[model samples]
Target: MSNQDSEPEIDNSDLEGNSRSQSSFGDAIEDQEDELGSSESGEQKSVTSDSSEDEEQNEIIRTGAMIQQSKGRKINKNERITPPFITKYELARVIGTRALQISKNSPIYVDPKDSIDPITIAEQEFNENKIPFIIRRYLPNGNFEDWELQELERLD
Candidate 1:
């Protein structure tokens, strides 16, 4: 094979087009600068140092005011603190964990009575709200609220 076959061909028209595009891009930037009031020294007129400092102070004051307002606000009692009821997934997790503890000879909260099954005893303890466990429900903002097992309404 020849060297020409191995090497990629450069089109002169493509090179000319690229050079024209580059020049046009530079021209567009210059036009934008001109429209934005660029001085003869190529310096753009922006907010003065004193004005910028005043803006920063105003921003800080606004932020402080917002924080103060938030602090002064009282929590509404009508707002649901904990979930209305325990979710099936949460109940399953709690039951599974309690059952495991029971299997490992951990003290059960409720009397097993005739039922010797660990899961059955765990369910009874959960129904009677005998478990002293807190469920940490997390919010989308990474904040979490610890709700006691007794605090949540149980569904049959």
Candidate 2:
């Protein structure tokens, strides 16, 4: 009764998770010259739980920088066999809006033909538009025909 009552009633699960998440690779860290428990003189500290945020804030990936890729996964039917590949910087530059701001109805409109593919329209939009904007295809992951970067193909 004495030891149990005296013990702190803190749950450390969340604290442990927070500590473990920060140890993720490729995170941004700004160092300070102040003593322990001291705040920076004129800098606002930024903090968050998302691991990917670290790469965006600090320096961008230069040439020959290491990038994380899924290594041991076997080729599965669910996975996209031929997904579009663009440079990271090029993708960022082309997509004026982030994934959040892109709307499903924004691109890939109905075609004049009886049956048309969405990917063709998407490809069309991406190729024709002078000002780069986010072009998201609504088609499921594997079948790119439903969602494409080109405007019109044989089906279109």
Top candidate by lDDT: 1
Instruction: Locate the minimum summed-lDDT window of 10 residues in model 2.
Output: 143-152
1-156, model 1: which lDDT tens digit per residue? 999999998878856555533445546554666756656457755854311333342111010112333224322336435456777777887888778878999887777999989999999998888876655554443334445577678677
**TM-score per candidate, chains pooled:** 0.47, 0.19
Those runs of model 2 whose alpha carbons end farther than 4 Å from true positions after fitting are 1-103, 107-116, 130-156
Angstrom error at residue 33, model 2:
40
Model 1 lDDT on a 0 to 1 scale: 0.61
Would you list the C-alpha lDDT of every candidate in the order shown?
Answer: 0.61, 0.35
TM-score of 1: 0.47
Candidate 2 structure quality by residue, lDDT tens digits, 39-123? 5556668885322343342212112222332222223335544345444543443443322223444533234244344444444
